[model samples]
Target: MGEALRTIAFKVKTASCGGTQCVNSFGDEQLAVDMLANNLLFEALKHSHFCKYACSEEIPELQDMGGP
Candidate 1:
């Protein structure tokens, strides 16, 4: 998670935060950075092998990650 966040922080510092936009699950305007951060964290947790479920502001529903 730390690594993912760090990567996202670096991206935010080096790139434009408004590169893209879309509507999230909650119908809120989502930016590219927002999606990137969410995907980063989700991948981090999924690969960590301990996260069975996750939820975020961008996706306000619990997601199953095939954990046992």
Candidate 2:
């Protein structure tokens, strides 16, 4: 197939270091863990359908669903 797709794997760290006890170096206060999971789930599926490569914390394995 001529279409091209790619996957980006992001490392996620869960810790008590947030807000007053937050230890995140970046100091991001955008999305919460639960919301992040929900959003990631939908985002992953939305992109995975035709992605040549798919990966995420929601998925345990790399998926090849399309032509490179």
Candidate 3:
């Protein structure tokens, strides 16, 4: 969990800019840091064998991690 949080923090800190503003599924302006954080969390959860599920405010549904 600590490593996952650290990875998310690192991605947010290093997110790039200069792209045209884009709207997300929520119809809101998508920020680089927001996208990076989402991706980092998804990846972390996907790779965590101990995680049985995950849910985020950014996503509408739950993610199954395939854990026993």
Candidate 4:
């Protein structure tokens, strides 16, 4: 997706076996990029697509749940 939210910049990134999203807070991009170390990946996970699997910044531990 092309940046639509007035607060955050969303980039759709796909994987070989799943999908993921990279969200950067807009209007306050710099700070948001830095706050990632403190925010929970799952919390940012809402309202987005319910992909077959979700991964944090770099595809941490994940289990396949088949397909939905």
TM-score list, all predictions: 0.79, 0.30, 0.59, 0.25
Clashes of 2: 4
- CA lDDT of each candidate? 0.86, 0.43, 0.71, 0.35
TM-score of 3: 0.59
Q: Is candidate 1 or candidate 3 better by lDDT?
A: 1
Task: Please provide, for model 3 over 3-63, each residue's C-alpha lDDT reduced to its tens digit, 9 standing for 90 to 100.
Answer: 8789777776776755635676677777767766776777776787777877765664888
In Å, residue 12's CA in model 1 sits off its true spot by 1.5
From the highest TM-score down, the ranking of the candidates is 1, 3, 2, 4
Worst window of 10 by summed lDDT in candidate 4: 11-20
Task: Tell me which residue pairs clash in candidate 2.
Answer: 17-22, 17-23, 18-21, 18-22
Query: Candidate 3 — what's its lDDT?
Result: 0.71
Q: Which portions of model 3 show Cα errors greater than 4 Å?
A: 1-3, 16-29
State candidate 2's TM-score.
Answer: 0.30
